[model samples]
Target chain A: MAFEFEYSAKNPLYPVSYLKLRAMHSRLEIIWTGQAENQAQGLAQRVEQEMLAMEREFNRFSEKSPLAVLNLKAAMEDVSVGEDLFMALELSEAFRRGTRGYFDIATSTSCGKDMVSYTLNPKSHSVRFNAPEVTLDLGGFAKGFALERVSRMLSDEGVERALLNFGSSSISALGTHPYGEWWAVGVDHTKQHGIVAKEVRLKDSAMSVSGRNYKGEYHIVNPHTGASVAAEELILVEGRSALVCEVLSTALYAAPKTEREAIVSQYDGYRASEILCGDCGSVSIRKIG
Target chain B: MNRKEFLSDCGKIGFAGVTLSLFPWLQSCSDKAKQEVKGEKARIGIIGTGSRGCFHIKHLVQMPNVEVVALCDNYRPHLEDAAQYYPKAKLYDDYRHLLEQRDVEGVIIATPLYLHAPMTLDALSAGKRVFCEKSMGYTLDECLEVYNKRKETNGVLFIGQQRLFDPKYIKAMSMIHEGKIGDVVGVRNYWYRNNNWRRDVPSPELERHINWRLYSEYSRGLMTELACHQLQNGSWALGMLPEQVMGSGHLVHWLKEDKRDVYDCVSAIFTYPNGVNMTFESIISNKHFGMGEQILGTNGTIDLVTGMYYSDEPAPKGSGMHQLIAQIESGVMSNSVFAGTSWAAESSPLAPGVPIMTNVKVVTGESTVGAEADGSRELLEAFIHATITGRQPEKVLEESYYATQFALLADKAMHENQILRLDEKYKIPYTPLK
Candidate 1:
């Protein structure tokens, strides 16, 4: 599935510059408008470069990646990570705690440890595992972190209008579309033939989508149970920060339907919804804040 | 360190690392060099005032450093039509007369396929740099003759396989070399156009002259006219010529027309030295598939036409917990892991085509040529730059020679019904047909 960053010169004064690239086995698009031509171009290039760097550092598939190296040595001894990896790990820890362990990153087929087994040293920018089984995978948090960073970069570059989409799952809108009042994003319902089940309009906001892994099996493995999430639920989170949206979306999807509202209420300026896919192909959408 | 300082340091390291690591080799031909060359103008001439010749004029007129000084064609109508575009250019009915113009430093040959070798030879012999339209010649002998002449005259020869200069293609090739897609295993290219492949003739005598592409004596039909670009791309991407070729062609749908001797459809498979095979298909009866080239590497597939690529393996995804986070964020859910053990069932995601040229914004709807046709303008610029600077484009002759050789051999393989290997004897001894 290829994704394109559609740019329009409809308003020449605010010409859009967009680039689409692949990273983390997903399509990422960055569209920037309302800046000087050269600045917009530079920001787009910087965004892509940052995303690729994050992929190189965080991707577990690459054995040479920083995350893989950390996963290898963190279990045995304290592993001093680079500044970027350390920050991402810190955010992962925060989300893991904030989601009450529902948003664990180590509960994979390869690494199955919860946040309690990991300890961070802020002064050294290092992490150590309390248990030998503890392993770190930043795949879940990387895109969100990258998006948030890119948004900051764009904003720093004085880009007043831009849209950063990391796959269809994570999106950050800075300002608004060149022509429209707000950056409108669609929430795709995969079970419903990948239709636009919901539309979100944002100005200086970020949104993330998490639900049915394209694979038919339970991809959302519960850290507490070590079992895959069986509930067919679609979760969407809109918040001021992409990382926050991503964390809340995943936590709510894994949390029971009754607990979703409570989980979302904990975060200010965060709105979430769950689309439950019933066995009969029926969908139930419940909104929460 | 604080979060802000850490983040800032990380961003700087990443930006520098990625920028330095990628595309180090492409730094040789910098925009500064192009701008330097663009400062000077080179006077050029156009021979064979046909559709392609006129297209060259259109792009040439737009170029800053190129002045179309002369136009030549035996056909009066084509000459007149081209003359309308460059009214001040010295027009001539004979190409030899056009070559005689002392001010014409370079010539763009977009005549019939059969005329490529002779026109290029004349142009080079006249001390004018040549940009000949592709399928270097009608036969192996003609191609060799031109290749030898280029070496003998020390003239700059750039064949019009525009894709060679296409930014998208250059970028794609760079990615392929960078192992972004791993090793290229195979290539599949097809050109499908729904047309009778005919041109209107003012007189019966002009039928053969005007529609030369449909005649075996003047052209190799789809192989030379259409498939050469794709074949050139395949060879370029593979960085080697085909060792052997096997293929077939048939009149198929256009048999009712007696004037046309060339086949309407052709298909060939070329095996390169690395054991990689390139499959080419062209048909004039269908336009559904349109035209595109696919370079299938072990890791990914690049669609040269669309400027996009799809990976063979699914993108490196985050863990299940990552998916759960995303699910919660999006407010949608279905099943857990949809990807089964069957790799075949899994679909790889498509990424936007990487830009071949750095520091150039790919703007859509600009008067600048579309991605498919931009090669012409780029090639023209390179040709003009070469003419003025006296610096020949790197590997253009060698690439052109191999592409033409492969094209002719593929046609031979199809007609003879045999797997033909490129022999040394074919490269030597330029035997001009009597």
Candidate 2:
């Protein structure tokens, strides 16, 4: 929880008001650009409220939280979940298969200890654990899920020019910056201070950056080996879908280097860039198909 | 992190009202506490207006709800120079006269090491809050006396341990306490400087008064003057005290012809209760590796001075794709992952160290005077808040006490040329490493 990602607005010359809030144990910032100042302010407040609501609903820390309740009760019997929770689980299941079980929430429930087996019933909007150890921790999926909802909220509210950044990792942009074709977001150099290893331009798209370095050792564990990934590279996935990019970024980062290209290829229109840095801050970026 | 974002993080990271039990002293730093101390001016007096005093004055003059009501010093020039910042303040040649002023509710003592204990005791007895510069005292007994007096008087006391109030340190310590770097194995601290550390005196009679840091009677050499701050790192990161200490000191660089008995170089190794060794080495001859405190752990190492962490586990190298990219960058065409099935698995132990905290200005420990954003201003602000509220910060005196004790013991060990064990009487009730 002490880990934080840095956020920098590439085009500072553009006119936009930033709405900042704390959610999901990290900083969430929304840069809103609109003709009416009052409208934008109102939208910022609504977005903050919605994000806090989602945080409360999905937070595993609170025993009474929806996610916590399901994690606690679903092991014994089929526990019905909310529509949002069900959708998140279904999407996580699809990602699990797509990433060849590399991106799994259940294995991380107890820090990769004990095998995880769970089944999701879409028709009943419920989940049942086949194994007693099959607890679900949605930490890897929550940010992306929340970003998708924020994207929907902005679209329904007729907001076209907005940027949603959750924890500086899960990001979704509704439109381009006022001055440029797309909003320019720089990827922080894994080792060097004040250095941007890569700059990603996003226009009506989403980007997700995942790495085990920022959060300390063994922060991200591989489900296959139940051990932390020792790779120092940062995996950045940018695509049209925030959810897909988020899942792919984490999956590709945790998967073996050989399977990365195949895992990324499973998702359409999504590209993953592996940022490799030498000892002296020399960065090499490898793109996966 | 900026102030706004930092406070937002404090709220979100359970430092707000939710779970301040971890860092109870930080309760005053919360946004809620910020609102509580609003619109309350704290009248303060400066006891010693030298360079360090002037540094505090610079921050004091800029602080809201803080008024410099008095200035005092035996040296007229320093006092007069500091008076320029607060012309309305009453000037006195003696600190006792300044303490007598009813309006001055608190006193900041940035005097010589020998004077810290007596001045703090006097300020406390005068029913005034006290903020004393560190090396709590010239001797361990004095430190204990001053510490016990504060308890008896129930007066507010703040030491010049700025790292406690620094954002990066706070964040790093939070991670450390949460086992981010894993079990702490060793603590390595060193301060290297190239200068003789002598200040220019305007008059021959003022030589001893101006450069008190080089004298044995007025100072405890590098241990008290410099090592005091570094000695506290081990206890803080581990929440346990060193069991014994042994070391050696000698004038390896600056000779005795400079008219100083204090050693120009010294090295000490402190054995903690857990058998972990915390080492301190300082020399005035070289500036390489300027100054740093590294908390070595099983999994990683935290460079507190630079706010960086180097994990022990090396990063596994990328596939042949990285070679392809490097070749393309170097303007060489090569058949890469698309054409090659043969690859080598490689790992590099020299991975680029990740920064523990960003956006905050980290100090390199080169300043003789205080450095900016080094928690000096924030510590002063916290003192002002304490003086206004009439409440003491939690665990501050305990930490200052242990640091002073460590330094004093190290000095004694070096002087005796034998390993010294901590006396049982000095131990206090405190938390231990889990």
Candidate 3:
């Protein structure tokens, strides 16, 4: 449950800098390499601003957050939404359909079978909840969404080498490490302290790791069943899209074993791996395409 | 990050990494020792029950592989306070009495700077493993004597050079040695505190006994007490010792009211074999800077205390993908596995440096006695493992010996105001512990 979120460059010779902040119920970190100090500071401030904007828009726990306001008003009538919120809803809906409802943002317990919990009005830029009990939560989706945006921001800023990580779960890497071919990261064991479950090498890609935390409490819920899934294995998904990786990791972990490959097959250039700790004191890694 | 991940990260340097380099002795500091012991406990005895001694006791009680068999202190209150942690352990007023016990397999000497050499020598001679606190000795002669005694007794001796066991230092040192920060330029070390460096005395006669650090006879003041730890940074990063040392000391602040003869402000500069200078300065008047040890290189700087690296060069103006493409076209790219992502416009150029290792608790060195996440606990754990396995951690004694000499020599350089080299008599051949 206590994960080690460490990022290192191989034999790095250039000056690498990073920015750390608390956002969206997680610690958000951005590391920029081979950049001048002033440029890195400017770029880091921009990235921080981007993530903060998204966090303010997506955070439902805050009373003044846009999501909370929408959740409260949309049930009774169509509520106007901003571009960021609207985009997040559209992405969530797409992933929900892509994962066959396994990645639902709207709690399914409040909706009828085979029914969409909320309707998005593109023309009016508004959302209306179909059911009175419908509540929208982006706790699992915001990190990925923010990482994807930050990734694009770094790409846009002409930053060649960088790493962005959110709460040790959502991660994005641009270019290779200054010294090595890839940015190396370790997935910590879910049950054992300090034990590395998997070592993932990433370059120009993103990865999401999902599992029960230190207390053996599952954070990912099965959107279809409306209950936390009890998975013994840690699920890791890596791909070019940070958003896709985050959605798939959560969906695959919540879904049953038989349906994981099918769900992953829906996405291109993505790979999922199930890390299991065996009684024989060895880690068993099964790769899925 | 935990022990394994930290050690594993430090394992990968471009050249000879910290784990695989000169300090081969750190093998015992890893978690492998816990596995080797197989739940067996190492019987440990404490010679002093001051703040640092209790600090060790705090770590000892938590360790499942260590048992506090004996506790000794001349002060009854201190002994009683420490006994509360492990009431089962026998208590003694005198350390010699504690050393006589057959059950005490190893002893942790945290009495004072002056007592380190004598207690360590006695513990080793008594057929017990010794974990002596730094500086290794009160004087250069004592340091040499203790070094020779370890060989004479063929005993397992662990010095309090905790940086060698710290994960942040290991990671930073690895990066430094790997040319991450470019060629080593210079080393800057400073410790600033605002306290009077005094402890409450129960009676009038116990002033020197309670406040040992403020006296020349009992301690080397700030040099041995503080600078010894930071002095190791230059040698560890450059892989060589200083050739000469010169400095000045003054009783700047806490002067008239106290009988303390030790200087409150001291500055020493050590010139290495490569002609690079390592500077040390401690002032008790201000606590603004706190404490910091930095290794300055041509390309960048590494703050060993805070574990951050700052670069001297300016950042490039374009995207990494674009830079990679340019490098590829120019045939200057060293990274073979390059996949181009989207390239874009340039941003403003200014940024704060990154931490060498993330998730580590960075101590600001405010606590005069002990600080958390400062490698003290791990150092004690390594010593306990050494005692249980009967294997001496190689090069630890040499490092501690030289660090002690630096402190003592710096003191001499300050008092005499002349540059002093290590006496040929004190130089000992480096040997790996078998």
* DockQ for all candidate structures vs. native: 0.02, 0.01, 0.01
Local accuracy of candidate 2 as per-residue lDDT tens digits, A32-60: 55425566567667777787778787888
Cα lDDT tens digits, model 3, A1-289, are 1112222233245555667666775666666666666777777777767777887899888899989998889889999999989998999989988898888888534786457888999999999998888888997788888888888888887878877767667778998766568876667554443456677788999989887754456667888787899888878898998888888988999898989989999998899999887653578999876
* lDDT assessment of candidate 2: 0.78
Q: Provide the overall lDDT of each model, using Cα atoms, as 2-decimal numbers.
A: 0.72, 0.78, 0.79
Alpha carbon lDDT at B173, candidate 2: 72
TM-score of chain A of each: 0.88, 0.89, 0.92
Highest lDDT scorer: 3
**lDDT: worst 10-residue window of model 2 chain B:** B337-346
User: Where does model 1 sit among the CAPRI classes?
Assistant: incorrect
Q: What TM-scores do the predictions have?
A: 0.56, 0.59, 0.56
Docking level for model 3: incorrect
Per-residue lDDT of B320-407 in model 3, one digit per residue for the tens? 3334333433434442221111111111112246777666568787888888778787788778888998988778878788888998
lDDT of 2 at B97: 91
- Candidate 2 stretches with Cα past 4 Å from truth are A1-289, B1-14, B17-19, B315-347, B432-434
Q: List runs of model 1 lying over 4 Å from the truth.
A: A1-195, A198-289, B1-29, B35-39, B316-373, B428-434
